[model samples]
Target: MTHETTRIHPAALMYAEEEKAGKLSRREFLARTTALGVTAATAYGLIGAAQPAQAGGHAQQGGTIRMQMEVRALKDPRTFDWPQIAYFAHGWLEYLIEYNNDGSFAPMLLSSWDVNDDATVYTLNVRPGVTWNDGTPFTAADVARNIEGWCDRNVEGNSMAGRFAVLIDDATGTAIEGGIEIVDDLTVRLNLPASDISLIAGMSDYPAAVTPANFDPENMLGNPVGTGPYLPEGLEVGVRATLVRNEGHDWWGYAEGKGAFLDRIEYIDYGTDPSAWVAAAAADEVDMFYETTGEFIEIIEGIGWERTEIASGASIVIRPNQLAEVDGMTPYADKRVRQAIAMAIDNNVVLELGYNDRGEVARNQHVGPMHPAWADVPRIEYNPARALELLTEAGMADFEMDIVSIDDDWRKNTTDAVAAQLRDAGFNVKRTIIPGSTFWNDWTKYPFSSTDWNHRPLDTQILGLAYRSGEAWNESGFANAEFDALLAQANAIADADARREVMAELQQIMTDEGVTIQPYWRSLYRHAKPGFVGWDMHIAYLPQMYKVGLAA
Candidate 1:
């Protein structure tokens, strides 16, 4: 029963030992190992656990796995407005890496990668013999093009610009001239200006889907060129999307007996109502859910379908826009006002009212316990009396504030709970609920709003996206030179223990500044019928349909 443990990374081996010591869950152990380039089968072998039924050519390859999710419009991969759009487009578009359910990563378009000791340079080894559905050879140039597009802030609605900022010059919004180097047909090198340990993890993000060097946004739907296994057959926005397997070409992973197991994949829009999905699941109309909220978990379970859960950093941030103004005054610009808003509401109450208490109460800091670089920082106590004092000191005691949120059940409930708490604290509060279609249009521009941020493997990744000055997705308009500097210092340190020391300071700064009231770290769930293999709940809500199929 000897496993192939010799080639496992030292860090992954350490994680295995920790698992043996009862310090890590099996899922967590596999996640760390797969992220470090060890295959899932090998990691399972090391623990003497049976591999998934689909692994090693045991997969049933011809059934469909229909999921209940919104089918949003498809456009440039970098400008995907919502995660559902990314999840839908992911059927045809693939990333360089796959972030697993347990916060680990798996190689996708790129075979493997190596990062320097200081995390300044990343040598990406592109998977050879891979080709687009149209038979175009996939190469390092395609990878370079995708990276360049992500680093370009000039592209309107390019959400990836913030995460790719590490490779760009501050003066120029575009990537540095020599930041991406094509070493050969199969190798690509990244020369980062600063050390960023999250760069590789960032690639697995939904928006980082790689496209051909000459990809055209206008013809995206007509001729979607990707290295994935599925091709768009039908896409009726807000209704349904049908993706059929690329029978014309063999997927790159087929030889490895990994993903591309399902013959057809379907995404049906059940709207924002969980009740609609509950009924649909009961009727056997949908095989699984894009995500199962706490309110419907019991109903879905009563249907006898199995569920997978993962503790993730996915959470909502209710905060005021520091850069926006109201009545010729920027009330939230004062840190005291933001701090007062955070202090007025109890996160535990919000969790109970909004999520049915399905998650852990989160401090104002964005970092979560699941992240490798997480540090235990101070917690902000719920103190309405102190909150009122801070509000009076900031000259906002009577200033009315508006809270905006999407019209979905969980989000609206969460925002309503916060607004009620704020009103109870003697502050004037207003609530606005808008449709999902229109809400994301001006999401970042809202004076005060709640935004659901997806999970990133490292805390630094999410910080760069949401808090970094002038980044495209900096919804809170939070900017501090000192905090940014500390983040840079933390990103450069690759060792988790070393990075954690810096993370402690970063977490303190985030809480002290009151950037956002991050109420809870969500526990993501998904339910699938019996006999389905390889379909697991992803922490980030990424739809990894290529790996899913029913048993033979």
Candidate 2:
């Protein structure tokens, strides 16, 4: 038979797709598996991947996908720290762009957008007929409110402020750092103060959900409405949340098998116990859990639930209290002392004890290998001798310190290990493990704290938001003009390769002088029941609930 060289394998593409949808019998499935030269165990899938749902609009008359989450949930979208709020935000608020199922990003509320020469300006065209649950029109005003709320440091707990800082100015809530020219209800021209190529990614940044112009905190706690396909039916803090499908609206997700697959979603807050959550998953009481620690993996797998080891962007860093005198951690301010603490804590040991060696030891930089801008920087090794030398060199051989962390098992255990290592290096160490809620109440104000941060797709966005000089979320109190200049240069360059070179420089400088001691990265694990179909994992470390469905 004549064949086209570029054509795909018939058995590999169309043939398997037809049979994999559960359209073929067991015999057929086995035949196809054998023909494809694959193991049936890997190909057939546990819940039967062959039975994926066909798609249309959000008009499906469906069922519920119940989930149990860890304690300490996010009450507000704009003030979210933990990613649990992403499930609620995705229900209502819409982003200008969305990370799609195929590992690519596409426009959501924004039909499309364009950038000017220096990337200082972006013309965003909003989607038509999208409205809030209250029926108020979603316009440029709502976008302005959400972005401004993100930039306002006074607005409760907004971690995204630093990312939006350079792109906008305060003119009746929003002046386009240079100027915001509203062309129409659906279109606006954003003029930025500095050249920033990552502005669009920043637009889709977490807590970037579009909200009404009249945003209220109290209402947000109960149910701050947005333009999602589901409505918050009820929410009780750290207890339970009930969300129902909005029959009036359309879920804007694209591609095949895309739509509102669930009629409702109930988030059952299982408190802070991982074992309870794991038990619930084993008994099939809960449909999913975003994270399952290494200890419970065997139990969960034994229960026959589907498992996915996602290549997530999360790094665990030990940050020193640079501007606080509250703890005896004041010694962390000295560069040599900070370097000593960084060298003393062996990351591999922490990972082995805390994560069951699930992750790799990190380098001096925050950007992990999963990120696009990642450059292999120098790895700071575990060196007790070097740490003792540095402590003596800094004249702090007799120094004592207090390290604070979330009292949760993962963080507390890891910090305990780190504290022991530091004590061995001739430093007196005190460990104060507080509850997650209490620890985060004054999170950045903490001294000698170990923190776990989610991933941002671009390295520049993370650097700009969390490590930028004087930025709101700069946990390390890191401030360096040279680093800022290099970051700015990278943001403005627009060329991919050149920006990467600048990013490499930023990583090196932070390692040499940065305040945070990041020893390792954490692997992300998601456990789903056999009933879930079309659920995808986001490397950005947030849930994509709306794209998933309860099995029929």
Candidate 3:
């Protein structure tokens, strides 16, 4: 064995001890350990070969679990803009891997996977005998089709296109002819243009759910056929969505005697108001809620429900559309204008006033402390007077800019705080608060707006998916050749310490160019009843409902 495999990570050692003490589940132990670079087999050996199922022997089955959350539209999985869409779709649609809140990854649709030493080639072993709800066999071809969909830049707003860009020709906007190969009925191979450690992690993203070869993007709700244990029983868009157990269906996981504990799953719409959810929890109208923030965290906890918290890199970005124009001038197109806006507001105030000190102040860079590549760079000092000087220097001192935001509690508060700061700096600003139902309709087209970005395992993952030039999710229209090249270099280096050196350069470029004002890194929270089992707060706000059960 290599010296690396023999050495136990400090965090992994603690997790193994916790597993032995009965304070952590075997699944959680493996998740935390493997996330720290520990091999799965080694981790299992540490905790003993014979172990009980994660659900526990005393786990009760066949019960309903209701949650107060938004039920958004679902179309092509590649274009999902929010985690809720993926969370809801997961009831029926399954991802190739499960990226846990603790930074560990668990195998899902794929029984196992192997990556070459250079990380350029990935071999995926699909779980055999898995059947879609429509009785179609799920094989390697289906996985290849989903990968093809991710690499196709032709699909507008396909965020996965950027994440899987290595598999496609950037000039032609099409997947490279032989990038994906079906090695066998259960094996699929990925030949990437370059080394990328984020491939498996990308597959775990909400938008990367595997679909059938002939799956129709225009009609997902109509054809919600998947190998998951639950079936979509009802869907009412903004109202509510329900899933019932696929009775008598021989689920692939059942043979291992794991998961599929709940008979029914429901996601009821409670709008963007946290108080509405608090009221529901008080009256016992819901079993759990999607996420709790600000004042709602304590309120939900005081109701006798257990709170699960995760330190996440999730944050909100208040960015400008560098491509859009206002009053015959593209103000954000000027570097000074973007920089001035970035310097005007204080992220500390956003965290305190908007989030009620629920998170850590950000340094205007997308990378957060939780990310492996996060660098402690010099902070961009907040100086409104200096911001005004830059605005005047750019000949846009009085340019009227619009700040659009959703009417959600924390997001709107955060936007309001930014608008107030910009106004104090003598900039002309207009605030447009849209309903949650309409906010995402044309979210990326706004001249200036706030977008909630979820957490990724690697900082380079989000950089490729959202900031790279020509990426579908490049909401700020940020295209920098230097930034993209440096990103590729970072992805190629497998060592975290070495990759972090390149990330420092990336963070500097992102800040120097005034890409986006990322205020704070969120501390995510979720609440469930005392007897609730299996469900935990995910850093990305995902729900693995199949393993979620109620304790009797």
Candidate 4:
């Protein structure tokens, strides 16, 4: 043993004690101790043979990391609408590509891709020598199957299916044979019905992780399986999910020596208890907590933890289902009623009261002002009198409706503000603050709720997912043949200026016809312990956990 083998990390020393207490397996302890430059005999006084040195020397590994989130259930990667499920999936599942914070494309499982001049045909080439978590070789067939899996309605990944709609004839959910063709062992081609520039944006979409087509729902939603850097070995729905680094996993785009830096990462759901999370993080019981809302900014900063502030082009909107009806007509389905709600609330008030003025008030567009394609559409002026006039004109002077949201402090306050404004506009509104789990998990059950969306590198990414007619995440139940035509038109434009122009027209068209009130955009943030390193906020607002490591 060398001189460096004599020294042990304080965390590793504690982990060794936990191993001795039977809290950790011998293999785990050995991997961790060896990562700290200690052999088994040197680490735990064992009689085993000496082990070889680890590959890298910068970050000390082997500690079991505990992180906090607001997840209710860890199952069903297809329904990963919130941060909880997606965060864990980030470790165990790999996306085809990722969007950088600067709105540039970064290759992941797919090394490179090419598009035809018309953007109708896309050819994808996967990275060489990659294998799934189960040790199966990753190939073009896997990508093709995974693409088909997304289009399968039973898989319930239709939100992602919306992005890959070129593969399916929307009118009949039938696969267009040439739409997604496996060209070779490591190559696939996408022959779309029409030109769509948004195809590149789908590479980074959630549930973009490639999987074997034969992977049933049990393996997909219950015990997770993928070609990611890590694997959630024994994932249970409501309880904590334990992710172990796949030591033999040959991930294509691993930046660090072995990709996942930590040996074990545990996701602990704190539900709606922010104080419990803060206390755990402050005491080093947890290394990270997701989405530290602006209301808790002062408290997190006071705890002296490092926090990230990414201008999340994320929008907060009151989404009306537009499906509940009255005399064969959904009230919110009326453009005038939707416009009335937009004119009722002062978005700045909600920002100040609920968000602590930490975000930019949204324009009529769903896109952030930071994006190059942003177009400042006319916002319905904040006039409660005008809102009343519009409602009265629609013969709904004192209409009654229930508004729903999460029970969290931030959402509660925001919903309260929104409800008060809507009430003032001669609408009878009852607010229902459901649990965080129910709010996002059972989103389809409710007709109206204030929704929080994450940032997308391109507006078309979110548009294709949330705004398009028949999109799986179309919670607003909004549909318009004209809007659909303009959406395709926007995505078909290859020229930047022409795309922006079309995007502007789409923005105005949606504001004048859709069932939503874009109040403001949130400033997304995440807090980490002092010992954490290499963490970055992706454009998707999902933290990049692949590069995280404990400082040496």
Question: Candidate 3, overall lDDT?
Answer: 0.82
Query: Can you tell me which runs of candidate 1 are displaced by over 4 Å?
Result: 1-59
Which segments of model 2 are wrong by more than 4 Å?
Answer: 1-61, 71-76, 101-103, 153-156, 169-178, 221-223, 248-257, 327-329
Per-residue C-alpha lDDT of model 1 across residues 495-524, encoded as one tens digit per residue: 676788999999998989989989998888
Q: Across residues 169-189, which tens digit of lDDT does each residue of candidate 2 receive? A: 535333344356667898777
Off by over 4 Å in 4: 1-58, 72-76, 153-157, 221-224, 248-258, 326-329
RMSD of 2: 9.4
Displacement of residue 176 (Cα, Å) in model 3 is: 1.5
RMSD of each: 3.0, 9.4, 4.4, 13.6
- What is the alpha-carbon lDDT for the whole of candidate 2? 0.67
* lDDT digits (tens) for residues 1-552 of candidate 3: 111336666656666777799766555566545644455667777877653346434558888989988998778888888888877787778887877654567677877776666778887888778888778898998888888888888988888887777788878887887899999999998898888877777888888888876778677767777888877888899999898888856788788676788889999998998998888888888999898888888887787889988877899999998988777777799999999999899899888888898889998889876666678886567899999999999998877888999998999999999999999889999999999999999888789999999888777888897789978788898999999999989988765557889999999999899999999999988899888787778878766777788786
Question: Tens-digit lDDT track for model 4 on 165-234?
Answer: 7667656575666678998898888788888767666756665655554665455546556777777665
Better of 3 and 4 by lDDT: 3
Q: Which candidate achieves the best TM-score against the true structure?
A: 1
Task: Show pairs that collide, candidate 3.
Answer: none
Where does model 3 exceed 4 Å of error?
A: 1-58
lDDT of each: 0.82, 0.67, 0.82, 0.69
